[model samples]
Target: MTLAETLQTKLGEWKPAGDGRHSWAETFADSGWAVRIEADRTDTLGCQVWEVALDRVGQADASLTLSAWADRIAASVTGLPEKLKVVEIDQHQSAALLRSDTPGSRGNDVLYFEVRLAGLAKASIRRFKSEHAIGARREQIPFIITHEGLAKVVGDIAG
Candidate 1:
């Protein structure tokens, strides 16, 4: 199944918000409800970054990021609900990498990239983890590299 299809089947009833700005899919299982939101971007290394945000019944929100690779795509599932563990797997279903420790409230949750060209090596994924103890606490966010997209913006620097 395609990435979108796999997500839709697992999440259910995916509806495009509009203009490819964002889309949402939802499903309910024995555990509770799972909602996945997909946002599109014209930036990066000619690749589309998919952000999968999941929320369970009476639980905190968690998210994962996946992107196309040179040969295959990589996916990392993190921010699991309390007592839950983080899982990472490659396209082959084999264990590529894993991190069980709970991530900070703000920072990169997961990141994947496929660099078919030699220029991507010089590029870097700039990330920041923010926290607001004053009023409302913010959550972690990630920014990935895309080909012919945002990555192109820094191609000269990368080269």
Candidate 2:
């Protein structure tokens, strides 16, 4: 399934809808939820390259910063509900690279060009509120990026 569809399933009730190039939105209750992923591409020798970094999510989430990543695994799954965990991760060289502690296992890894987010439980959202602030902005819900969508964003032919 595509990223949009995967989000739809994971969210239980939120419907996925696209609003712009690589931008999507969903409606629930009276609020509208959405996210967008944009990557800069450089062409050399007829190949296109893509990248996404933890710094980018840091910029968006406002909880991750140069000083905050001393413990990556803790930070990766921190400040949120217990059930909605950050199961897999993929980071760019620009951002601290996070890999599985268990070796020889490969699946559900995110690449540079995508940010995957998923988690829910109204009470969870309420309890987690007022805890995340990376900059001047505040956030209650985290973005969910899907593994399959990560591949599809940069295209199956390339990373």
TM-score of each: 0.26, 0.23
Worst 10 residues of 2 by lDDT: 119-128
Across 1-159, the per-residue lDDT of candidate 1 in tens digits comes to 333333333333333344555644554444343434444643222223344333433332233222121112112221121111224434453222322233334353322221212211111222233343444343334344333233222222111
User: Cα-based RMSD of the predictions, in order?
Assistant: 15.8, 16.4
Cα lDDT, all candidates: 0.31, 0.26
lDDT of 2 by residue, 1-159 (tens): 443344334333323344322322233221222323232221111111122211111122345432233233333432211212233432432232222222221143221111232211010111112222234232222233343333232221110
Candidate 2 deviant stretches above 4 angstroms: 1-10, 15-64, 70-94, 104-159
Cα error of candidate 2 at position 20, Å: 19
Please name the candidate that would achieve the greatest lDDT relative to the true structure. Answer: 1
